[model samples]
Target: MDYATYIAGLPRVLAGAGVIFRDAEDRILLVEPNYRRDGKWILPGGTVESDEGETPRQAARREAAEEIGLDVALGPLLAVDWVPGTGRPPLVSYLYDGGVLDEAQLAAIRLQEAELTAWRLVAQDEAGSYLAADMQRRIRAALGALAAGRGAAELEDGYGPADLRAR
Candidate 1:
């Protein structure tokens, strides 16, 4: 097969990266996107530009800076979610730890005017009201991982139990 044909036949998937930013009170930061007609509140993130040679972690940090105007050293990986697609390729989402921001860092948040209309720090219990069901699940799992000091988690469609071991 020709190089073009081989490349064309290769599988393709879209990738996205987001940061889970929290405040001193442990509320998650949620952004209301202006570009979405459905008005889904989401974490600060966007699609990874493959052409830019950016890794998922880099993309997450860049998105945080671009969307929230906060330059922070991102913590470890929190969760990776593989979302099934409708008509297109599936989406692989990476969620990173933005770490708990102090009062000073929280005071400096500035939403990107072009993409976000508002931002709020919502408690964990109230995240479901602001986020989609799948996203809420992902965030909850990530929070659990954070509290336990465990490594990154793998999720399918935002659900856990990545592996089952015999008793």
Candidate 2:
């Protein structure tokens, strides 16, 4: 289980899980950071922690509630990103699709000032410029698979933006 590698890298490694919730109208939910650096814009998520009897999914829900104040219904896995040798820290990011909860359900959020500042629902088309290259690709894959009546697409195998280019 690569326990040795996992342990040796703990201080410099992290695992994060997050979801991109979508509504029936097909709009995608996104959060904008109050600040930006290194030309990077990221989604709302944080390090996945291991608590007694808690799974990664549970951690993800907790992160969502902590960051956005909503209890999300988690759906299928969308992507698994590996960030090794990126110079900051090695990370494995799990991206999921927490099915949409009504807007009326959103209340004032308690955000981690260190992670986010604002969030909004964006049309699938605008995701490119706003998100980092990889995140944009993941959003495109999720939207494409959703539009085709299939379940979530895996990002592990890799795909190109042209696979999701606007029609």
Candidate 3:
């Protein structure tokens, strides 16, 4: 079978999420999957379904609700990525800027057992160690874009519109 055929048999359309929450000192939110396949820690994200007729922002908000049981205020598009040779099909991820109501809400988080086991609020410097190299770059770039009053937009080499999960 060709690559397209192989990917078609895999799971749902791959998507992305912007892990956002507040710490005691007003930091960002992040999550760690319960299991590690590639021995890497990834940000919170999942599939983007075409049937949902949703934009990337809608997909991010949906993932936040389903994965963490929380409603998120979706912000600008943060970053885009493509994961290659990762067992599953090549994935196109659309990251967004997500925020919660307040820091107090971080305490009441309820994780979706089937997806994530727990969540954490980490400081900016601490993020690089816990997250994968690619994620670390994206997060840092997104933060930088937000700080500079610009939206983050980076397309990994070899990734194109055809890679989008919505397709």
lDDT of 1 by residue, 6-45 (tens): 9999999999999999988999999999887766799999
Instruction: Give the better candidate number (2 or 3) by lDDT.
Output: 2
Please, what are the lDDT tens digits per residue for candidate 3 over residues 1-167? 99989987887545555554445465667776877765555556666765677766777778788877777777777667666646665666777777544645665567888767667777888877777776776676666666688756565522334344544
lDDT of 1: 0.90
Against the true structure, what is each candidate's TM-score?
0.93, 0.72, 0.74
Model 1 lDDT at residue 5 = 100
Q: Rank candidates by TM-score, best first.
A: 1, 3, 2
Model 2, global lDDT? 0.67
Location of the lowest summed lDDT over 10 successive residues in candidate 3: 157-166
Clashing pairs in 3: 21-29
List the global CA lDDT of all models: 0.90, 0.67, 0.66
Model 1 RMSD in angstroms: 2.5
What shift in Å separates residue 47 of candidate 1 from its native position after superposition? 1.0
lDDT of 2 by residue, 69-108 (tens): 7777677776665655456767767777777656575445
Task: For candidate 3, give the lDDT of residue 52.
Answer: 71
Model 1, position 14, has a per-residue lDDT of 98
Query: In model 2, where is the ten-residue run with the lowest total lDDT?
Result: 157-166
